[model samples]
Target: MKKLLLFVIVFSVLSAATVTFWAHQPIIGMEEKPIEFSIKAGSGVRSSVEQIASAGVPVNPTLLGFLARLSGKSGRLKAGNYELKPGTTPLALIDQLARGEFAQEALVIIEGWTFRQMRQAVASHPALKHDTAALSDQELLAKINPQYGKPEGLFFPDTYLFAKGASDLQVYKQAHSLLQKRLNEAWGRRDPSLPYKSSYEALIMASIVEKETGQKSERNMIAAVFINRLKRGMLLQTDPTVIYGMGDAFKGNIRKRDLETDTPYNTYTRAGLPPTPIALPGAESLEAALNPAKTDALYFVSRGNGTSVFSSNLNDHNRAVNKYQR
Candidate 1:
């Protein structure tokens, strides 16, 4: 009986030593890269460890789960995506999971899209929690900011990265806050001689410039044209604002009658800037609107490809229009 007791003691010591060695062994992989792992919400510690074992981590589920419970970390498991690196050990996995370290997901907002398009992109993102899916534009605008009644041109265009499964509201707030910061900074440093009465008017001009920049190199020139026209008491006559006013009636093409139609956004029929921005403007367009190129150009027409020809007089503008538009 004494010999049997000694055998059991020796066997238990060897088992503990084996477990301790396994806990520190690094999980190497092909090309020594990291492996992706996920733990869904409500997953218990046992199931989570089983998932890790199945993710090619070279682990024993029962042993890892036992270790997790033994180390008093079973109740601290979090749900989200994880990047298990090349040197991650079985013990480190438990600690990493308990800390809720999640992989980031990205959403890219294009520069010239309207608020409606931006909302659609946010609502359809798989990684977002879809908390704002049912909210209308006006309703969502209220939640984002109450002072701004209209939603157009309020968001900055850029790639936003966030942890997996983050709420959609989090993204909106981040973008909104960043845009305000940039706009305020840009407004504070704007040129003193510009025609804008307020930063919002500059933003409105920036949106027009964003849409009209068929050739990125011509952004400053386009701003110069509008600025000259605004200064000379001439009609802006920009087609993009006219198209924006048409709304659903604009079938991808603008007719002469469409130009004649009266709307708050129709630059050809109305005077001064539009009531609000037509699209989200990027940094270049915003800068151009605030400080245009040093030129007398007051007219431009598209040259068929993505560029335009600028002219300072009506006769030259008409000649260029006949050369290009005809």
Candidate 2:
């Protein structure tokens, strides 16, 4: 009777040790580099175990399956791409899978970028599921939000994180929603004396401000210039709007003829704000547009450097232009 009890104890200890060894040992051939492993949605633990075994890992599927069940992780494995790096034990991998620790991918939308550029960036990301590539701008917008009248400047400029195989439409929806939320918040806190009739108009002004300067400190000043011009019934005469109006016809340089040419976005020709936003504006630009600096300056010219010189009149603006531009 004592011999039988000793034998059982020894066997149990050996079994526990074996399971520990299997759990701690890293997979074969993946000791030096990371391997991308995927578990499909709705896949059972048995299939996942089989996949690991097939990948040349020296794991006993039956044993691994039993261990997974014992650990209460059999039904908790998530479906997504995972990087099984060197030194990742079988047990660690299982834990990662159970916790839905997927490899995150990032998509960044830069400020001042056009919607077309945003679309191109989305299409170029290899990790994203590309459903919008074949869709037209209108079709894409409809998919993202049916109520959206236009796609331009609707998406917020920020870095969005997603798990692998995430749809482009999902990213677009996130950005669009964020933009709406931010726009509403900015609109609610906007200056009462601002000339913008609606949040959309403020968004348009924000986009203009975003394109006007890269200097963070200058955004409020630039917004003030545009706001002052709008209140005084002065033509915006902004070159960015004219350049946007030129579209494909715009070469690298803006000639005198180009400035004189008329289009819907040509603030020099049109009296008020453009029909739509010219580019995607960041949060700072949006805030600047809503709360402009208190300045009488109406005109500005780029000083050839990143900064610009603000002027109260055309004479000062032309002088700054001649000094910097020439």
Top candidate, metric TM-score = 2
Candidate 2 lDDT for residue 206 = 98
| Stretches > 4 Å off in candidate 2 | 21-31, 56-60
Worst 10 residues of 1 by lDDT: 27-36
The CA lDDT of each predicted structure is 0.89, 0.89
Model 2: per-residue Cα lDDT over 170-273, one tens digit each: 99999999999999999999999999888999999999999997689999999999999999999998889999989999888998988888899998778999
Poorly placed runs, candidate 1 (over 4 Å): 1-28, 31-99
Backbone clash pairs in model 2 (N, Cα, C under 3 Å; residues 3+ apart or in different chains), count: 0
List model 1 lDDT by residue over 1-326, tens digit each.
99999999999999889888988888674468777778888999888988877877677889889778877999999988887888878788888888887777899999999988999999899988998888888888899998887989989999999987789988988888877888888888888888889988999999999999988889989999999899988999999999999888989889999999999999988999999999999888998898889999999999999999999998999999999999
Count clashes in each candidate, considering only residues at least 3 apart in sequence or on different chains.
Answer: 0, 0
lDDT at 39 for candidate 2?
76
RMSD of 1: 4.2
